[model samples]
Target: MSLSDAAELLDVHKSTALRILQTLEAARFVRKTGAGTYVFGSGLIELSELTLGSMDLRQHAGGLLRDLQRRTGHTVHLAQLIGDEIIYVDKVDSPAFQAVQLPSRVGHAVSIYASAVGKVILAYLPRQERDRLLSHVVFERYTPTTFADRDSLEVELAGIRQRGWAVDNGEHDSYVMCVAVPVRDSRGQTVAAISVTAIEVVATLAKLEENLPLLFATARDVSAEMGHSA
Candidate 1:
């Protein structure tokens, strides 16, 4: 909505609305579109991490995560965005791929530019938001495959959007491969993600490809249970 419209709706002056919007923009609570329009910020979804909504989301998603873990025998993770970072809220570990999974606690923050789940969430966000996030990220290469610059990362994100999934390919480490897909909300907005990780030695890109349908199907099921019809 336009600033003037928002001002009228809130019964505030245009200047006051603009100032409030600017503050929310700084905090990533709202994002502007077009010349003066605004929409709920994708980062608001990030803030959902600490809310009862996130707990409910985890509960709704747990069974699907477990089933995916059992069917693939690969570690599964449920992650939500927090600004430019992603946090693991729940996981189901595969005994066979125990070493393949990274040592992550329930709230361990992961890089949005280097991890599978992070990239998938970023890749599906509005372009302006993705650009805004890219501006703030310092591309510290974690491994040989890590994106060294914004240009490369942008290209990869575009490819990920088209492919409907993302891969870590050892960008965060040299031994693990992670595959992730988006979890949409009622509005078809990707508010979270699910990922499967395995040792590169045991599972190649082709093997990860084979699991894509399973992973995506599980993500869909979770989204559905969260009241998303999409």
Candidate 2:
């Protein structure tokens, strides 16, 4: 708000409001806009996130992941881009398909170029950061569908950025298929990805694509939980 507006709201003298706002602006608790209005600043957001420390994204997204699993009847995975690797932080299996186990598990690292979740996160990252992450990777043709070279992987990543989502197409394992969407943080960085996975016999890639709307919705909800405004 403007200085006058703030003074009226706080029931203080305009000078008092200006002094208070100046202090907050110095600490970055609030920032003044070009239009002369005050808004919450990055420092305030950082402090809030730090306060919520241990109750991280995994905990915030757990209920949404379970709900997505129930709706899709497929295995759901949440993966985060930690340093140079994409690590599986959480997994939810469909209640009805509990006996049909796949190879994925929480705390496991997934192939960055061969997995849908990994690609989706990579696709939305800044070019320098993405290149840094991929620099250490040695591409391998895990399956016929895998983008086994940096050139081909770049093309696939480009497509994902254009489409706002990604597909595994049995890339890592010929029997497994997945579709993924990016999850953003409050600053609009794609910090994580959420994917739906299923064995070929259970659901083909085409079948999983049918649930893309649900997957995207779940991602948006999870991003909101992560403090993203949109």
Score each candidate by Cα lDDT.
0.85, 0.89
What is the C-alpha lDDT profile of model 2 across 122-176, one tens digit per residue? 8998999888888889899988999999899999999999999999998989989
What is the lDDT for 199 in model 1?
A: 80
Evaluated at residue 166, the lDDT of candidate 1 is 92
Error of 1 at 104 (Å): 2.6
- Each prediction's total of clashing residue pairs, residues at least 3 apart in sequence or on different chains, is 0, 0
What are the RMSDs of all candidates, in order?
Answer: 7.9, 12.5
lDDT of 1 at 57: 82
The TM-score of predicted model 1 comes to 0.77
Report how far residue 206 has shifted in candidate 2, in Å: 0.7
Regions of candidate 2 where Cα sits further than 4 Å from its true position: 1-55, 95-100
Which residue pairs does candidate 1 place in steric collision? none
Error of 2 at 207 (Å): 0.6
